[model samples]
Target: MAQLIDSLRADGICIIVVTHDMDLVKALDARLVYLIPDRPGAGKVSGGPVQSPDGPDGSRPVLLPVAAMDQRDEPPRRSSRSAYIASINPAFRLIGAFLTALPLLISLDWVSATVALVLELFLLMAAGFTPLRIVRSAWPIFLGAPGSALAIILYGKAGGATYWQWGMIHVTQRSLDLALATALRILAIGIPAIITVLGIDATDLADAFSQVLHLPERFVYGGLAGLRLFSVLRDDWSALSASRRSRGLGDENRFKAFFPQAFALLVLSIRRSTTLATAMEARGFGGTEERTHARVSDVGPRDYVYLLICLAVPVAALATAALTGRISYFGN
Candidate 1:
């Protein structure tokens, strides 16, 4: 991401990173951009960067000043809202679990997971993401859940009365129960995963994964390289789609044309990945035996709390059901 940003900026592209992390914003540039709210349009958004002096270490973190909309161009209020949220701190694992499963979560019936997922969504919204942005970020889970749900239903082999059979396929009372359980479990698992990930930034994720997992540096750096290419490929795919639309090719039946286009995208991605891997190898990225973390990634107190909650919920739910004599695993 740094490389990409640097490259873009070097080419005079207007790159703006709206971020809460002082460390990251400092890394990006000394000059900062501020978005101030309009008054009559109060909370109506307007923004621009006014460069301030750098930090003491000659890093010279430039502060951007904004003026009030109504005042005689008096420098706008520098609210501490952003600082407070950023200062609260977050746990790495909580971020990871959330990112990994959030999409599948949002796809699940909200009634079951609403209490948990809604809280996560609230946190993410407070972190400055819109609902649509959060949903889009989690969109991939929509594709992943059906395959998983299908696998559970097909293979779970519910031990009960058979209702229908075709070849080896069976629709038994047991199977139905298994399917429902499987679907619910998937939803429960997915929601928090999505929320955590969507809330955490990409750099934070990379740091957590590398530091917590103790992943091989080669694999980590190589994967990061590949990820950079993947992002480029995503952009390229969008451009290609727009081009296709301009060429009047967007009206084609989705299933038929989508596959070919998707295949083309896969090929493009693979090609980019190949190039990236080769470049990394040439740069001796895999040569290092010992590695050090550039940034701290700790599983803090909050992560443990979140994990405990994750473990406790189903346990409490199951116990309640058992006490009520409704805890039959088979629902017989």
Candidate 2:
């Protein structure tokens, strides 16, 4: 049961299981989903009692006993409370995630980027995202930034007093500054964007998007389904890439081989999409009713502060450049 839950978690599936087997529920670490049922006399809580584990000292356990899903005769039917809460509005999570990426998109100054990166790091730390994961995710940005900066230096020399000239190219002091600025800008934007979204859980993101952002329910659910499938496809792609390398296919890298592999991945993605769609439809998704939150996403006061700083830093940098005559608007 623990393994099953782990697998479901890895696949980014949101599941609310029902079971009478107490041990299984404990094993699965499932959360109790309470539902209030309408009775003839009065309304009463229809869900089963919430049980919790005892502590190491035999005190009451911290977490409540949630239902475990099981394959058995006469499976437990979902109650209104259980079903309603189980389906989280994906809008909030999605919108929040997108907004979190905003700082990286607009900020250009090193100071702005630096501040944004720090704030994003703070959020990740607060949200329990591992530092190792953050570092691992942010490294690629540095790897690519230099190359992009080099491109700007090589190509952005038009109308500059050429210090050195070659075929279709010129090098100047201004070009050097432009290269450094471009590299810094890229690093500033890329690092925060990656870290802010790296630890996001897809189902929670979907729920947040639906509830907070008021996105169309069908679109939110569809995106969730796609995200789940993408995880599987990414894993498959990695495996196939490795296998091909081992089989000497990687040794013979030609245009033909690349096209076929790309095509194969496309076909695999389509098949996975079809299979996921059919499975979701079979499970009675998109039922006629308003969805409720299984969990809620909140933007803390810290997020607002960070957003303000993201907006302010670039403005400050521009202001500083203006006062110092260092700011050149796109070399105009």
Q: Which candidate tops TM-score?
A: 2
Could you tell me the lDDT of residue 78 within candidate 2?
27
The most accurate candidate by lDDT is 2
**What local lDDT score does residue 93 receive in model 1, on the 0 to 100 scale?**
43
lDDT (10s digit) by residue, model 2, range 93-204: 2234455445345433344444445555565556555677556778997788889777766776655567776776777776766677667666555655564444455766
* Model 1: residue 215 alpha-carbon error in angstroms: 2.2
Please, what's the RMSD in Å of model 1? 14.8
lDDT score, candidate 2: 0.57
Off by over 4 Å in 2: 1-136, 159-161, 231-285
Q: What does the lDDT read for residue 55 in candidate 1?
A: 46
lDDT of model 1, residue 100: 38
Off by over 4 Å in 1: 1-187, 234-271, 282-284, 330-332
User: What lDDT does candidate 1 reach at residue 324?
Assistant: 55
lDDT (10s digit) by residue, model 1, range 67-104 = 45324342322222233233322444454464434433
